[model samples]
Structures are given as C-alpha cells and as structure tokens.
Target: MKIYEITFSPTGGTKKVADSLSNELGRDITGVDLSDNNEDLHEFSLKNEDIAIIAVPSYSGRVPATAAERISRIQGNGAKAIIVCVYGNRAYEDTLVELQDIVQKNGFLVVAAVAAIAEHSIAHKYAKDRPDKDDNRLLKEFAAKINEKLKKKDFSTPEIPGNRPYRKAGNAGIVPKPTKACTQCGLCASRCPVGAIDKNNPAKVNRKACISCMRCVSVCPHQARKINGLLLAIVNMMLKKACSIRKECELYI
Candidate 1:
C-alpha cells in the first residue's frame, strides 16, 4: 500500500505537522502539493489499497479555497484517508468537517481525523515553536493507532467536528506590500498561490485576488514584504486572548 502525503501548507507550519505524522505512518510516501497552482490535481489518483493523508492549514477556521478546490480534483477511488487540519492555536471551527466532506466526495474513505496547533501564520506570537517535541510524540501515537485500524480493516469514517454550513469566512485584507528593499525578484509572484502578485512588478498586487495567506511575506528572501503595522497590531490584539492559552493536538479514530 502506498502512502500519499497530500497537503496545502502556505507558510510551512501545516506541512511540518503533516510530514512528522507521515514519517511515523510509513517509509514509502509520495507527496501531493495542493498549493502548487500550476499542477494538474486531477491527474492524481489512488486505489483502494492506498492511504492518503490529506492535510491543510485552517484559514479563519475554514479550509482554504485553493486547497479545497485542488483536493476535490484528486481521484481517491475509495482509498482510506486521514484528514488533518492545522490551526494557529485558535479553533479550527469547520475546517476538519469541510475537508472530510471534500475528500469523501472525491471517493476517499476517511478512517481518522486530527486537529493540530501551529504558530499563527500572521501573528507569530501565538502557538510559537509548535509541532514541537510534544506535538510530534502525540502525532506518532496517532499514527500507530491509524496503522492498527488499517490492520483491522477498519475503514469506518471517524466522527469529524464542525458545522455543515461553515461559518462565513472573514475578510482577509492583510495584503503584504513590497518595501523599498524589494528588488523586483519576482519570487513573490512566482510563489503566490493565488497569482495575486504581479510578475513584472513585484510591488503591484491584486488586493481582490489576494487570499492573504502570507505566502509572499513568508517567502521573501530580502524580508522586503510587510503588512501594515496598525492593521497587524489590531489583529494581534484581537487574537491575543484566544491564542494566549496553549492548545493541544486532538485525534479521532
């Protein structure tokens, strides 16, 4: 049986958790990057003997549209799947349920689910240094349980959390603007998941198109991109209380 590590991690935190769990799950693993805009997601297919670990970062407590859309294109062919939603300390309200639905609709049979905490992509203060030692241990345990289930031929779907009609996604208007330090390297444009940045003019961004995933900000080699100070401060204040107390990883099997 093959193990597929399918993920959409814009800022690396989600991928970190996914990779750790996958390492514990199996030795032979194949990666399917849902964040790559140029790839044809429909080309990927799986058989009943395959296992797919579909992981994505929770954006405002919901699955990112790009991830969701890409995930729906893959042909699961009744392969067993483990759904994982990584959040930034805050609750991942409907992300798990929504992701389960998407993958199941595409013919995956979800056998397990996980909700994990990672550092906030925007506000780095919350859940800092996460997917750390403790998280990895817990994930390893989860992987063992999943392997047991598979051995038992338990393909029953786990009860995933979240509402059917997901909460309305809040406006993600924190577009990163290139600072004077920007050299118009076009790296930001090339790496943008949504094609929000202009390739010719790195400074130019389509605000309407930007999902505010901060891929450009995180990938900037020169540290040239930045969000507005006042806006970032306001966001930090709003998330302070929710992110103050540390949250732990959760598993459903």
Candidate 2:
C-alpha cells in the first residue's frame, strides 16, 4: 500500500515530528506539502489501499486555516489516515479533532490520531529542541502500532479529543518584519503558505491575510525577518506557565 506523508509545517518543527513517525511507518513515502501555496492541492489523490499520515502544527490550539483548507481539497478516496497534530509544550487543544474532521470529510478513513510535541515556533525556549530523542522513540512506537493495525486491516476510528464547538481560534498578532539584512530575494513571499507577503517587495506583508505561521522568518536565509521584541516578550510571559512543563506524545487508536 502507498504511504502518503502530508504535512503543513511552517517552521519545520511539525515536519520533524512527522518525519520521525513516517520513517518508522515505512519506506518510499510520498510527501504532500500542505504548506506550499504554489502547488495545486486538488491534484493530490489517494486510493483505498493507501495510508496517509496527515500532520499539521497547532496554531493557537486550532487547525491552521490555510492547512485545513488545503487538506480539504485532497481526494482521499477512502484511504486509511493517521491524523497527527504537533504543538509546542503548551497544548494542542482542538487541533487534532479539527484535523480529524477535515480529513474525514475529505474521504479519508481515520484509523489513528497522535498529538506530538515539537519546539515552539515563536517562543524558542518552550519545548526547545523537541521531537527530541525521547519524542522520536515514542513516535516510533506509535508507528509500530499503526503498522500492525494496518496489517490486521483494522480501520476503527479512534476516539478523538476536543469539544464539539471548538474554541474560537486565537489571533497570533505577531508578524515578522524585514530587518536591515533583508535582501529582497522574494524567497519569503514565494514561500509564504498564505501568500501574505508580496513577491516583488518581500518587506510588504498583508497583516490581515497573514496567519502568523512564521514561515517567512524560518525560511529567510539572511535571518532578516523578526518579530517585534516587545510583543514577543509579552507572548513569552503569557505562555510561560503553560509551556514550562514538558509535554509528551499521545496516541489514540
């Protein structure tokens, strides 16, 4: 059976967790990058005999709007799916449930769900260097169970956690702006998942359209994009307690 690794990782943390799981699941994995706005998401189609690891990072305890929209466009064709939501040590809250609903609606048969931890995209100190050795070990174990289930032809939908009426997604008001080091190479604009940045003038960002995924900042070769120091400091303080304790990976099947 074909294995599709679908992911929307703005700053690589989510992708790191996904890679660990996917590597343990099997080989010859076909990847579908939900973060690429340039790709035609409608073109990705899966067969009934395939398995998909649909993963995304939790944005403010909710599915990223752009990722959810792109995932909804894929033709699942009843493929068995394992939903994965990666987050900082804080909490994933509604992300897994929301992602599960989206993939199911797109024709995927949900088999398993996982909530994994990764380094915080914005707050670097929280969950720093995560999806670390311990995280990978747990993810590998999760993959083994999923593989066994697939071999048994078991497609039972796991009981996913979250409220029916999901909490309203919080705004990540922090937007990265260009610094003196910005070379205007257009990389950030082209790589932005939401098309919030202007290609001609990379410095220009549509704040309203921006989901604050931090892709531009992560991809900037010159390390020129930066969030306002004061604003970031405020966020760090607010998330301090919630993100202080180390979180572990959780699997449902």
Candidate 3:
C-alpha cells in the first residue's frame, strides 16, 4: 500500500507538522506538494489500497481557497484519507471539517483526523517554535493509532470538529509585498501558490487573487516581502489574546 503525503504549507509550519506524522507512518512516502501551482493538480489517482495523508494550514479559520480548489480536482478513487489541520496556537475552527468534506467529496474515505499546533506563520510570538519535540512524540503516538485503524476491515468515518457553515472572512486587511530590499528576484512569483505575484516583475502582486498565506514572504531570500507595519501592529494586538495561550494536538479515529 502506498502512503501519499499531500500538503499545502506556505510558510513551512504546516509542512513541519505533516512531515512528523508522515515520518511515523512509514518509509518511502510519496510527497504531493499542494502549494506548487506549477504542478497539474488534477492528474493524480490513488488505488483503494493506498492511503492519503492530507495536511493543510488554516487560513482565517477556514480552508485556503487555493488549496481547497486544487485539492478538489484530485481524484481520490476511494482511497483512505487521513485529514490533518495544522494551525498556530489560534484555533483551527472549520479547517478540519472543511478538509474532511473536501477529501470525501473527492472520493476518499475518511478514516482519521488530526488537529495539530505549530508556530504561527504571521505571528511568531504565538505557538512559538511548535510541533516541538514534545509534539513530535505525540504525533508518533497518533501515527501508531492511525496505522492500527488501517488494519480494520470495516472502516468507520470519524466525526471531525468544525462548523458546517464556515465563518466569513473579514475585510481585506493587509497583504504582504516586497519592500525596497526586493531584488526583483522571481522566486516569490514562481513560488506563490496562488500565482498572485508577477514572474517578470516580482514586485507586482495581484492583491485580488492573493490569499495572504505568506508563501512569498517566507520564501524570499532577501527578506523583502512584508505587510504594512501599522496594519501588522493592529493584527498583532488583536491576535494577542487568541495566540498567547499554548494549544496542543488532538487525534480522532
């Protein structure tokens, strides 16, 4: 049986959590990076014997539109899927339920679900340096349980946590853009999951299409991409309450 590790991680925090769970599952894992817009999102198909471990970060307590759209195109073909939502200390809210629904609608059987905490992509002070050593050990324990579930003949769909009607996103706050430090390097443009950045002129960003996932900012080698300082300060203050508390991981099977 093949193990497919499918993920949409912009700033690497989600991927970090995904990797730990995948590593404990088995060796020779097939990685499907959902963040790459260059890849043909619709081509892959999995057999019934295969297991798909899908991991994605929560964007404003909802599934990122780009990631959800790309994931919807994949043909699961009745393969078992383990849905994982990695969030900062802030709540994951509807992310896991939305992901479970998406994967199931795409033809995968939902067998397990996990909500794990990682360092905040935009806010470093929240859940700082997470999916830490302790989280790793706990993830391994979660993986072992998932492995056991795979052995069962009658698969039961686990109840995942989240809202049916997802919360509507607030006003478009601030989107990150390259600063004077930008070298016009095309890395940010090419690496943008939503193709919001222009490849020829990396400074140009189509804000309408941008999800503010921070992929460009995280991958920028020059430390150029950033949101407006004043707006960021406002966000920092707002999220302080939700982010100050440490959160833990939970698994359902």
Q: What TM-score do all the candidates reach, one by one?
A: 0.98, 0.98, 0.96
lDDT for residue 58 in candidate 2, whole number 0-100: 92
Question: Which of the two, 1 or 3, has more TM-score?
Answer: 1
lDDT of 3 by residue, 88-138 (tens): 888989999999989999999999999999888877778888989999999
lDDT accuracy of residue 10 in candidate 2: 86
Report, for every candidate in turn, its global Cα lDDT versus the true structure. 0.91, 0.92, 0.87
Q: After superposition, how far is residue 163 of candidate 3 from its true place, in Å?
A: 1.9
lDDT of 2: 0.92
Report clash pairs, candidate 3. none
RMSD of each: 0.8, 0.8, 1.3
Q: Pick out the ten consecutive residues of candidate 2 with the lowest summed lDDT.
A: 36-45
